[model samples]
Target: DVKVTQSSRYLVKRTGEKVFLECVQDMDHENMFWYRQDPGLGLRLIYFSYDVKMKEKGDIPEGYSVSREKKERFSLILESASTNQTSMYLCASSLQGHEAFFGQGTRLTVV
Candidate 1:
């Protein structure tokens, strides 16, 4: 089975602090995505990488950036964590379709 691993299950941070969330996938999938899932706003894409060293901005990339230095690893960096940025961050991998294999998720809380 394909597996995605997140660095942490929960994280708490103060406003204006930098945050880093890491994700690694075992599958050799071509696409890796970072999304923030809120109560009603649904999953908002933050960033995605189709290949190593190549990245693309998603729907909501203002407060976030991403890194894809290897085929199996991806990272999401919050330049400055804010209260509004507190949400469930999810990492996903897929070949091309809308269907994706998702990680358990990382719950981030910014105070």
Candidate 2:
């Protein structure tokens, strides 16, 4: 079974702080994605990479960046975290055009 692991399950940070969220996938999937989930707004894609060292910006990329130097790892960076940025972050991995396997998710709170 494919498994996606997140570095942390919960995090709390002060406003204007820098934050880093890491994700790793055991499967040799070619596609990896980072998404932020909010109550009513649903899941909004932040970034994605289809190949090692190749990345694409998703729907919401402001104040966020991603690194995919390795095939099985993807990292999301918040340049300067803010209160509005507090949300659940999800990492997913999948083969091209196939169903994606998601991590348990990391909940971030900015005060």
**TM-score, every prediction:** 0.95, 0.97
Model 2 TM-score (2 dp): 0.97
Tens-digit lDDT track of model 2 for 1-111:
669999999999999898999999999999999999999999999999999999999999999999998999999999899999999999999999999999999999999
lDDT of 1 by residue, 1-111 (tens): 889999999999999999999999998888999999999899999999998998999999998989999989999999999999999999998886757899999999999
Report model 1's TM-score to 2 decimal places: 0.95
Q: Give per-residue lDDT, candidate 1, residue 80.
A: 91
In candidate 2, which residue ranges exceed 4 Å CA deviation?
Answer: none
Which residue pairs collide, candidate 2? none
Best-fitting candidate, measured by TM-score?
Answer: 2
Ten-residue segment with the worst summed lDDT in candidate 1?
92-101
